[model samples]
Target chain A: MSNGARNPNRWLAFSASIAVVALTAACSSGGTTASPDTGTGDGGSDGDVVLEFAQWWEPELPDGVLRGLMDEFEAENPGITVELLSGPYASTKEQVVAGAASGTMSDVVGLDGAWVSDFVQQGAIADLSALMDDAGYDQTQLASQVQLDGSTYMVPVVNFAYMLFSNDAMLADAGVDVPSTRSEFADAAAALTSGNTTGWILPLSLEAPNGIQNDVMSWVWASGGSMLDNGQPDVTNDDVKSAVEFIVDLDSAGVIAPGAATLKEQDKVEEFTNGRVGMMISSLAHINTIRESNPDLEFTISALPAADGYSGERGTPYASWGIGVAENSEHKAEAWKLIDFLMSESSNAQLADAANAFPGNTTARPEFVDNDPIFQEAFDVWQAGYPANEFVGLPVAEQLMRDFSEQLQRVLAGEISVDEALENAQAAWTDEF
Target chain B: MTATLTPEVEAADRQPTPPSSRVRLRRLWDRLTPFGFLSPTLILLIILMVTPIAMVVGYSLMDRVITAPESNFVGFENYVEVLTDPVFATAVKNTIYFAGVSVVAHFVLGMGFALMLNSPILSHRLKAVFRTIYILPWLFTIAIVAVLWRMLLSPNGIVNYLVTTFGFTESSVEWLSDPNLALHAVTFINIWSGYPFFMISLLAGLQGIPRDLYEAARIDRAGPIKQFLHVTLPQLKPIVISMALLDFIWTTQQFALIWMTTGGGPINRTEMVSTYTYKLAFATYDFSVASAAAVIVLVLSMVLAFFYVRHQKSRD
Candidate 1:
């Protein structure tokens, strides 16, 4: 910081600090559920305890409904007021990393179950075993949420299982019945497949392409393939390769979208919603968003289209979101209170009413499943035992997903073979790891 | 200066102590005040700019998160990995292409607008009205700009609607979906949002030029194109060059608009250096590699700047 260069940056930092302070105040004000007792006969201006909550569900969720709940929680507690901070899903990992390093983490955080390992590795999150016990949450369910290191950092909220959804009218219009077996599925897809319509729409957008992969797993598991063998990376495994080859051949058959390689994530949603496609391997959670977009469209939900080499046991990963306490929080007790409330039956029911999500608690799942037809199918998938194993490779895994997608795009664009694309994914994952 | 006329009698003994010492002290104060005034700013800059940059540079050289706190220092491993990576190479090429093409297009369109507004044939009132309207896009916050563009360029958006109505195309084009078109689509918005700054600047530059220079040129048989090449361009040189520099930097690091509209997709054919760096650092949390990418950005920008400044020096 020489004399000449120092001044401009100083101004930028000062301005940034002032802006952050103002933003903090604005954020804090939004969560002020007025405490009934704090307003009178108290020496303190506001409650001394300031609870903190962090979540990665913003932008997707409707504006601040969860925050409103927190405010009410605060108002109910005379000596406590909760403050909520939000980060987008993509940045949630980084926020925790940076926030932890800088000692600025909120008292409580919301995270995806897949990220539990990374958080544990970095020591960025804390074990919530005691936190769960205090609330009387189920231990087996809590253990399922724990990382490989045996620490339960996540208080699981939303339970997501991917399922195959069909545009029933489109299939009827195309004179094709909903397919059950691999052969039937292929035939049905071929009949409906056209320039304007693909037999199926699945996003191959390498990053967060989990929904499509989850559906694709139907064939993989059906073909007796496994993504990993006994909780280990197994890219070179025979069953996995055979399963991948099935999709590759279908890709060659032109049953998917022409621009599938270049399609945006939202494009897939629109394709399904706008009746441009007949089937999509999508989330049961997205049913409401799609249904709301086109209420008149008749749709169906079913288990993954059956494939050859069927194994009765399904292979899947839990795509769950959870809540946790921030390690450095000054108001840990209050945060725990809010977490407990949100975990309770009433709050869980409210959450189900607000959005379509399977609550992770065995007791709460019934409330969430009753709301939508698609979610019922999701529950069936869960019953079929398509267990979502812990996400392997972590930070490297995300990079690999992106890299794999880019290579897949090339294949989709007619620039390469599917075999080569898989090879590239292997290489990319190896290099990253 | 004889000691107040020998004190005019003893009553005028102390005539403010011959004020020259005060004057010298005042001169010293004047010379040093700027640094004092600027000290607060300097300290802030060190904390924000210099320190963070240094930290990034250090992290760039490390293997990062693997052995992190205890990891032995490995110089340039991250940089070497990234520079050799095909993904990063594509990102670099795309970023360079974006900066080069957008800056040039901005200059031409901006200069054209400035000339149009400078025209004396238009009434002053009309010019002012058009000027105000032209700057509306520029005044909008970037998020607003992105939302507006998303609507205008969507598969069923207004642009495709207009094209269909005019019979220019048979169907709606997903303008930002095609790999070939996504970069251009993002660039189009960048240009739309950027050109006005250059236009406003060049117009002001045009205002400063003597109107009589054009009059003299006309008398000397110069046409509009000829006058532009000889007179207007020469006079607008400083602003044009400076605007070009600014455009290059701003467009290179652009993220928010692209994030909102595209998310670096259509298979990342829309990838730029800054966005790629962000995805690596924040989205993926690969700190060492992301820090490497950022350091590359800084080095490349500095090199580009050096060349531009050198060219300017040579010209001078």
Candidate 2:
């Protein structure tokens, strides 16, 4: 043998080159070979239609129910297939933004209700009412949430309404009943707060934008202050000012958690479930988790407390996670089929119960309510809840929510007066509009 | 050698024999080969770093709402708006406070650790172990550190548990909540996670310093404190300055730790420039304003770097 053949280094190099080639070959072939049958077709041969549904669920939440729905849909419709793309809820907005920017968005997307109006304004989502009508689906049976400005751009399969959740045991221990008015609520919170526990806790973290918006907006609405009136930012509304004053009072009185401004919804929920919080405004979806966290903890759901001497419907801010077809999608018909299947009376109830939320279909609501006895009151409160599609119709809605959160934090921290904070926030809102 | 020649001709002759054009071309090719090899990376840097920065500068001059389809040129408006915005002022103030305090804390703690680790009494193996242990925090991801610190500082968390258990105070302190303390709490976490980088760098500098200096100091009967002041500090000046400069830059740009923890809240007490810019971009979807803020941050960093480099050269 020649010197090169005898050399171990030469042999090693040859082996490494072979290995690299093999690895490259394997990597290139892996996806197609391993999941040949499960591959997403690009509306090509074999008469296959593949639709990608992007959502924040199917990752952390129990996905068995969603998987069953997809399987049933696929079985019923042999030619069409549904692919689930799951990601963390925190990254939902970013993912959608990037997807839209790159023009590679999923065919069907489960958008946060807050994002729906913005998407509609940007023409990022298609009008789905026509599709719904063509399928002989009664548009009236759809949740009021799906209809924005008398037109439906999405279909909410399930929903979670933000409402007041009280630790009945803690309230009783403090010698206070579930407060139905702002003053009573404040009194209850102040009375209950002692030791390591806070009287009233809501995740006020500006980092958790949705959490802040859901909890804070309920107060403004309950005080009969519309966030936007006639497409104008309305933070200077007297009712909103009073709401800010109430929040500041709560903070100064030390009824709220010490670092409540930095806590997320999950943190606040953890505190509540662990018997540390007396009262909190939370979503109807958390009932099961709260029970699981502490079986002995007695809690009651109630409508948001109205302002004193005010007579209006209680502010129940329920957000529905709805499915919308991307405007740029190629397989719009297939995407609608998947959405239609999920929102079908049968699938809607199952998905809602599985996800621990309310059904968006009116037909499915009764069955879902019947199944979950604990969430019955929450459902009823949500039934009379403020309409979802109204406030967020403005393009400035998100900015308005963000300004409210930041300014509210300032007010709570006593860095600024309620009037000043509200005025500054309103100024920002006005400048933007 | 006897022939008188002009300076240019003489220099050219001394360089080498004037080659044929083909040979000159080959020589030029040889001279340019290394740069030719490096051009790809240079191009990548230009494409990746320079292009984006230029785009940001361009965007700063536009009226770009992130998700909106339309963006008209609005020169200097974004910058004017951002500068006048109270939140931007708060962010700048918070960034300075965070970076200033955290950098000082890191330096002090890092110097202490480095001194201890560099002590002559410890075996090499023991020093290695201690070094590894100290750098553990640096090895952990910022996300993990943020989560860990959050859990520790939570009202019902173990830090409170220990505080109550040890009877340090009757009540549990809200470490990340109080506006007065939230910035400090986040600074403490930043210092804890970051000091290791300084310590390791300073320790390496210490090891490189000759033992003769310390011996010379001892010969003059200089005590430990005096030696540290005169010998150790002077010897470590270059490393200290370099580390301090790097730490200042890193701390100023820090986003995740403060963002994941307080989110510039408790009324924007801990709102750093990075977090504020992120909020403007992602949360508010006002990328033009964010770009303006970013340009300001970039300019501040460049000015600091320029002064640092100039000072370093002056010292040399």
Candidate 2: residue A280 Cα off by (Å): 1.4
Q: Across residues B158-183, which tens digit of lDDT does each residue of candidate 1 receive?
A: 89889988998986676876677888
**TM-score of model number 1:** 0.80
| Candidate 2 deviation (Cα RMSD) | 9.6
Task: Show the lowest summed lDDT stretch of 10 residues, model 2 chain A.
Answer: A30-39
Query: Model 2 over residues A1-433: C-alpha lDDT tens digits?
Result: 8887788654554444333323322332211111122222267477688877778877645747677789999999898877877667766566775565445667888876667776776667778877776776666767654556778886767777777889888888889999989999999999888888888886777677555567766787765566677767787888777777787788888888766767888987888898888888888778878878889998888888988887877666767777888887887777778887887788888888777788877788545577665677777777675643334455545655666677777777667788888888888778766
Worst 10 residues of 1 chain A by lDDT: A34-43
Chain B TM-score of model 1, please? 0.84
* Residue B231 displacement (Å), model 1: 0.8
Candidate number with greatest DockQ:
1
CAPRI quality of model 1:
incorrect
Question: Candidate 1, residues A312-405: lDDT per residue as tens digits?
Answer: 6655444666777666565555667777777666666566445566665545555546655566666776677655533432544455556656
TM-score of each: 0.80, 0.85
Residue A8 of model 1, lDDT score: 64
